[model samples]
Target: MEHPILFISLILEKLGLPIPHGLIGETFLEKMCQPYMTYTWFVMIFLVVVGKLTLSNIEMIPGKGQNFWEMLIGGMYDFFEENMGRELAEKLFPMIATFGLYIAVANLIGLIPGFMSPTASINTTVALTIIVWVTHHIIGIRAHGLGYIKHFLGPIPVLIPLMLFIEIISNIARLASLSIRLFGNIMAKETLLTILFILAGAYFAPLPIMVLGVLVSLVQAMVFVLLTVVYFGQANEHAH
Candidate 1:
């Protein structure tokens, strides 16, 4: 089972890509059944089983996975508490945590054999960005009501229309920036890794690239999460 770009791209869209394109031309049953019967499925299943077993045995002792999870949760908690305040952070924790976990896990999944990261696709990143954009505005309206619109109007009457126009365009630009940044970084990393493997006989040359890829993956996830926080801050700011 070769995981070609087309196949990977198709699976990503099925999971939830923002762009409109038919990646997989297969019926529902075929897609569902094929996963369970494929080699990738076996690897996934094996990892799940091993992960569970490892956790079970570590009931009295902390291991790498538990430590990593703790660190992630603690870091996010601190970040939100500082920026959003404890009450608001608590209120928004579920949404923030879900996005962070989903994206972080998706990025990490790419490190595994045969599985591609959905975040590597522009469609997926764009969809996520749009959702964030909508969520920020909705939260803003709910919090500040009509005043949410005032945030775009600026302080001077003469600049109201101009400010509004600027705000709207800037918000739209976020969608393109977020999507392109993620897609370009992931695609470049994958392409570089392939070239390295080909040129340096598969093992030694890919080592450094793989290490860099992991760092880049983590950074991308962090960037996405931080940008969401910034958007939330802007949307919820009180217009004076």
Candidate 2:
């Protein structure tokens, strides 16, 4: 099947820039500028620019921009607090917010004519899963010290072997679940939208699906954040 053309790469080529494929031909720049990676960098830069603009001027009365950001940050903080408790929310608000914004933007960008969602790439999702996996384990170790091992070992001494094996498998499964879930959903969404637009042969025909895509994008991002919060909460808990 023919894939949708990544307009970002096309633009770079037109601008006489070094791109991954046609212009650069098998070079290091080509390796670095994979479609997903290029869009990922765009998302990061977009977030950084928006954040800088939002924080550049603090107003007591709060303008429209300020109010929107305040509502977004405050609402997200409340949601995290509700799910993970105030203390954990306070500790993790920044990381969770960053993940939510990045994922949400990355997902939505693909719906635009020129861009593709980075999360559609398994490599990108795997990287995100790895970060969450390592972070929660670190949180567990820091919270419980060496006793974190007891989390994997059941209370009964006789069950340690079975419990440890089960826990190891479960944790590995978590990694796969997180990565594959995001990657599959996004890949499917992008592929379906692309095919729908092509089959319909008109831009307006896919309007309803595009609207649904926006909702799916936001819901997926929220689901990812919620699961992360749950994992952190579990890691923060005392051994049962």
Candidate 3:
């Protein structure tokens, strides 16, 4: 599977850079979406809506848009602040909330005809996992400097190599686990819905599943955010 958001290559191609068509030389466009655009189009739309909602509010007394933004972002702020401390939460809110809200929107977008959630693609989930992994580590290094790597060496000096290897494996596992969990749930849900509509030949058969899918989507997004918080906390342990 070629990663869908290879924007650098796409831009280069647009500029007449002459991208070769194979393996490392070429990038594949996202194939899942139809008619005109892929899930990327929906992602762009979601970002635009979120941007308008968040940026259009500039008053103390809230209007409808401000109220909506406050309820959404404020609740997330409180949740992370309580769990991860005010300073860290404030620093992390933009990235954390963006991922959480984006995933939720992506999942929900599938309910629309002719649209699919970007989260349904493993490429998308893997990209998100990479972002979370890299961001937390960057925070860790910034917070602890040279001492940040000690955590991977284990509590005892004698077992440093073994522990370091284990830690490396564990971190890699986190990337895979995060990506697969999101991808499996989303792909499974969509697949089941398709199966129901085709096999059972009844629209009613998928209604209950669709309702359940909404709940699953919300939970998955929260779980992704919560896991990021856990990583963030782990990385910044020295700060406290």
Candidate 4:
């Protein structure tokens, strides 16, 4: 089946409108196709659509169509400034802000009629967590040289083996925690909303759930951003 929302989003994006790509339909032709399509093609498609939309409106000022983008950019900048200091924030802003915007937009997109939040998927969350985990270590090493590994070895030489093991486990847990937290919350919200729609099918019945979904989306976005900042901070600290 053709996704009308996706079609409309594509058209609007072409015309330089502010419509979000998440309004599009998300269905696989069969259950067997769901795993492959959802995990791989969906991310690729999302990147392409959002990339085109972003590039097309690059020259536009803050208008009705562009207000959301402007708000997101402004908010992330302000947040970075508050947490990371102006200099560091400016240096790291591009990477952090890009993650925040992409994730926030992706989460909010779920509230739209047809689209599913990719963040709700375990595959997406796990992949993102892995990337973040690797990024944290890479930055730490770059900043501190070989001494970055020393952080895990502890301040004392005798504790090196034990400390290293603990650090490694903790890092692995970070990935699991981040992925599970995001996936569980989003999936739960989606499931609850779906059940509500099934049970009541009344307009007002789903309103409250939808509102909650919006809040959850924002919270999830903030959590991801905050964790990113924390990870960066840890890396920078070791570097120093």
Candidate 5:
């Protein structure tokens, strides 16, 4: 099959709904694949919808669903508060939390037999990287004003141009680094599982790898969030 997770389309088709036209037609890997409607794209949207419903359906008084949602949000609030400080973290909490949960769910779900991690796709990852990158810069500018540009310059006047040039490249490089890191890790994990399934055809042997994948998934998501936090912190910092 052209698509890595062909069964996703198959199952959706058998549900009596029309098969997604794009899936029925061409492979995502094919030339001129539209970015808007890939399997991973749908999966990402499905997750966001579920999360929105979960939050929307929550009650004021505690119950199973409310408690679960509260704990998740509460814990994340504390986590970011500790990392980025109460003020900055609270300010950026929504963006950080959303990014973290989406990525974490996307990675973990890919462990299932028929799901593919959207982060495994360069397009998905690059888009995320761009979002994070733009967010920090916008926050930085709003927080610190034009003085933010001074951070790119070195302490010494003579080195200002060189430092500014290097800093520009370094900041831009973050987009590539963020995209490649997430994509490489997820793609490697999926590729390894595929190879093991083909070679041994045993259910048990891949269990260890799957367990490791879970840890790696969480770590990758955490790393992505933490780096964003770091950027946010740096962005708001006053130039010395």
Candidate 6:
């Protein structure tokens, strides 16, 4: 599949620092040439720099950067606490916060002229969904020990086989659901902006769409995190 060329890649080529094409060959891990992967690296480094700056100068009187981060992170923590209660929230906040921050940033980065949303890629979304699936199972196991398997079994012993089959399929469906939803939304937003730019010219075409895109980015991130929390909450529950 041919990927769209990005402004960043063009600049890199012009400066004699072109990103390697398919640096890993044609294996499943071959994303080096993808514009989305290039921007994924960009978003990671961008987040790290912003995080460092935000935490570097902790003032007795909070500065703008400190205050902004405090509000964002603190608000998210409070949200988790409310949904999952204090104990589970504390246990899961770091993972939840990482997902929220990364998705939110990745979704918005595409709005910039030289960038693309990593979440706009199916591979990125699938990888994220797999992480959530694995982490939630680990949480369930830690909470329940070897009894985690009971989650797939019904209360009635006679129904265990049937319930297990159904539950297993249901869990697999979640992986598809999470990945496709994020990828579809972000990809659609990017496609729409491209069409509008072509139809009406860049300067005047995309202003309204960009505004809506910002809202979509934040809302989608929130929805993904909230669903993840719900899955974690379910896993932590003692199976009936």
* Candidate 2 lDDT score relative to the true structure: 0.87
Among all candidates shown, the one with the greatest lDDT: 2
Cα-based lDDT for every prediction: 0.69, 0.87, 0.76, 0.70, 0.77, 0.85
lDDT of 3 by residue, 43-96 (tens): 767688877866675898887777887798889899999778889998888889
- What tens-digit string does per-residue lDDT give for candidate 1 at 42-127? 33455567557656555445688777656777899899888766776788887887677666666666665456666655666777
**TM-scores for the candidates:** 0.74, 0.90, 0.79, 0.71, 0.81, 0.87
Instruction: Give the per-residue lDDT digits (tens) of candidate 6, residues 137-236.
Output: 9989999999999999978999998999999999999999999999999998988877776778546888999999999999999999999998988898
> Which parts of model 2 have CA positions greater than 4 angstroms off?
21-26
Most TM-score-accurate candidate: 2
Model 5 lDDT tens row, 1-240: 123455755665566544444423354343223322345666678777876777676566877766887898898888888776788887889888889888898888778876677777777788888999998899889987888888789688899889999989998899889889999999888778777766674656667889999999999999999898888888877776
What overall lDDT, based on C-alpha atoms, would model 1 receive against the true structure? 0.69
Give the deviation of candidate 2 from the true structure as CA RMSD.
2.5
Give the backbone clash total of model 3. 0
Clashes of 5: 0
lDDT value, residue 177 of candidate 6: 93
**How high is the lDDT of residue 183 in model 2?**
89
**All candidates: CA RMSD (Å):** 6.1, 2.5, 6.2, 7.6, 4.0, 2.9
Output the better candidate (3/4) by lDDT. 3
User: Which parts of model 3 have CA positions greater than 4 angstroms off?
Assistant: 1-37, 50-57, 201-203
> For residues 1-240, could you state the per-residue lDDT of candidate 4 as single tens digits?
122234334544566544422423244333323332342445456766866676566555655546766776788888877775677678878887767766776777666655666676677788888888898888788878988887677678898788889988997888889889988988787667667666785666878888988999889878998998888778767522
Model 6 RMSD in Å is 2.9
Supply candidate 5's per-residue lDDT for 20: 41
